[model samples]
Target: MSTNLTSETAAPTRVALVTGGSGGIGRAVVERLARDGFALGVHYSGNKAKADETVAAIVAGGGRAIAIGGDVAEERDMSAAFDAVEAEFGGIDVVVNTAGIMILSPIATMDLDELDRMLRTNVRGTFVVSQQAARRVRSGGAIVNFSTSVTRTQFPSYGGYVASKAAVESMTLILARELRGKDVTVNAVAPGPTATPLFLTGKDDVAIAGLAQAVPLQRLGQPTDIAETVAFLAGSARWINGQVIFTNGGLA
Candidate 1:
C-alpha cells in the first residue's frame, strides 16, 4: 500500500517510527500507538512479510501505517528508514527503538562474534536510530529505547546481553541530558522476561514456570504490558525523561 501519505501534503497526525515493529513486543507497540492516533511506520530488518502483516492489521483497523525495512545497525539504512517515514508522514514525532538481538552465553565461553553482533544491533542500533531521532523528532516528541532487566538481575548466562543493555541505559541517560533545551523526552524501557518469541525460544516449560513464579506477579509479562508502558512514554508522560522504566512485573 502507498501509506496514503506524501511530503506535499501537510501531516494531520502525529507520526511514530517503531523499529523491529514486526516482532512481538514491537507489534504490540505499533498497535497501541495506532490506537493512540499516531501515523505508524512499522520497521523490520529482514522480515518484510511480518512487517506487511503489521501494516495490514493497522490499515484494517482504520489506522495509517506503512512497512519500512532496513538494517538498524547501518547508519545509511537507518537514515533511509527515517527519511521514508518523514517523506510519507511529513515529520516524525516519536521513535521507539525495539530492534535488538539476544544470544545467551557466559562471559568466559561466549563467542566474540555473537557479542559483537548483539552489541551492533542493541547498542549501535540504538545509537544510530537515536541520533536520527534527536535530529528529526519534533518538539515535545519522545524517544523510547529498549533495554533488558537482565542488567539488574545479573544473570549468569546473560553477561554479554547485560553488557549491551548497560550501554543502552547509559546512552539513554546521556542523550536525554544532551537534548538540553529541545523539549524532547528520551527514556529507556527495561522489560523483564516478556513472553515474546525472542524470550521464549530456548526455555522449557519448567524453566519458564520457574521464571514466572520468581516474578512478584507470578506470571510472565505480556507484550501488551510493555506496549502500555511505551504508549505512556510516547504520549503525555513528559516529565518522565532520562529514566529507565522497568516493566517487568516488579521483577528486580
Candidate 2:
C-alpha cells in the first residue's frame, strides 16, 4: 500500500466540518483533511468567495468538499451550517473550529465595544458551534477547538484576546468530560505565533522576526504545522482528551 494518504486512499464516508475554513489555519486544515480522505464542510463567516475557491480546489483535487457560510455566534446560522453539512455528506464525524480574531489591546484601556466584539465572536462563537456539535456529531467523532499559546505567554496587550481564548480552553476541557461514553474526544490546540495573516496583519518585520526567534525551534509556525495536530486529534489520538495541546514549537 502506498504511504501517501489522499482522497483515494481511505473511506470518503467519514466527514469533517471546519469553521473559518476560508483562510488562515482553517484553510490548511481543510487541505490536510481532504488528503486524509474525509469529505469536508468548509465553513466561512463572511467571505464566501474564498470559501468557494477553497471548495473548488479540493474538488479539483478529487476530494469531496463544500462551502458553508454562517456567523459562528448565531445559533440559527451555525445550526443551518450543520444541517447543510449533514444533508450533503450524511453525517459529521469531526469538527475543527479555527475561527477566531486577535485584537491586541491592554485590559485597562480597551474599549468596551472592542472587548464586546472580541468576546462575541471568540467566546460566544465557540459556544454556539460546540453546542451544535455536541448534539449532532456522530459516534467516534472528535472536536478540536483553537486556542493560543499566549494564554501561557501572558504577553502584553493580549489581555482581551487571551481572555477570549481562555474561555475556549475552559469549554474544551469541560466538553471532553461532558461527552463521556459518547466516544467523542474534545481537545484544544494552542498555537504560538504562526505565520498566518491573523498574526502578521499588524506587525512590522522586526516584531515578526523577534517572535520567530523566541520559539526554541528558531522559526515561526506554519498553518500546516497546526493543521497537522488537528488532523491527528480528529482521526487518531483517541486517548488524548480534555487537555490543551500546545502546538507551539517548544515555545514555553
Candidate 3:
C-alpha cells in the first residue's frame, strides 16, 4: 500500500483541489499552494466572479489554476470537481476542504433549520469531499479539513457550530487511520477568530477588538496565517497526521 511519490521520484509539479476557494481562508490557501508549485483547482459553490478573481490572480502571478463550481455537500458536485482537477492536472495530490458556514445560536433556542444547514455544509460537506480525496489523491498527498478553535473553547451560543466541527475532527482522524500505509496524511486546521469576512460580518468594532485582545497574540488571525499551516500539511508535513493543528494564536 506504500505508493509514496516523493518529489525526488514524482512529477515536477503537484496538483491540489481547494474547496471554497472563493472565500477568505480558501483564497489564501489557493495562492499559497500555487506559489508552492501546485497546479490548483479552486472550487467555489456560488459566486463565480470571486472564484474567477482568485484564479486570475494566480494566473497573473504566473501560477497555474482553474476555477470549478460545485456544492461541497453534494457528492456528484464534489466528484465532478475532483474529476475536473484530475483531468486537467493528470492526477490529484492534495485536497483542502475549507468550505463551511457558521450560524451561531444557543442549542436551547437555536433554529433547527439553521442547525441542519450548518451540519450539511460543515459536517456532511467535509465527509463528501474527504471521500473523494481518499479515493483519488495520489500517494504522498494530504487532505486538510477546516475546523474551528471554538470546538476546544466551548463558547456559549456556539453549540451548533461546535458540533459540526467536532464531527469534522472525528472524521479526519478516522480517515487518516483508514488510509493506513497509503502514504496520505489527513488532518484538520482549527483556527480562532480569523479576520475573514465570515468572522467579521455583523460584528461591531468593539466585539472585534474584544476577540483580538482575547488572543495572546493580541490580534486576530489573518488568512495568510492559516494558509501557512495548510501549506505545511498539504506539502511536506507527512509525519503530522490524524491530528487537529490549532492555529488560534494561543486563544485556546
lDDT of 3 by residue, 1-252 (tens): 779997788866899999999889999999999888999999999899999999999999999999999999999999899999989889999999999998878889999999999999999999999999999999899999999999888988889999999999999999999999899999999999999998988789998999999999999999999999999999779899999999999996
**Model 1 steric clash pairs:** none
Worst 10 residues of 2 by lDDT: 4-13
Give all candidates' CA lDDT scores.
0.94, 0.94, 0.94
Candidate 2 per-residue C-alpha lDDT over 16-72 given as tens digits, one digit per residue, 9 for 90 to 100: 999999999999999999999999999999999999999999999999999999899
lDDT of 1 by residue, 93-181 (tens): 99999999999888999999989999999999999999999999999899999999888889789999999999999999999999999
Steric clashes per prediction: 0, 0, 0
Q: How far is candidate 1 from the true structure (C-alpha RMSD, Å)?
A: 4.7
RMSD of 3: 4.3
Give the residue spans of candidate 3 off by over 4 A.
1-11
Candidates in order, TM-scores: namely 0.95, 0.95, 0.95
Q: Give the lowest summed-lDDT range of ten residues in model 3.
A: 5-14
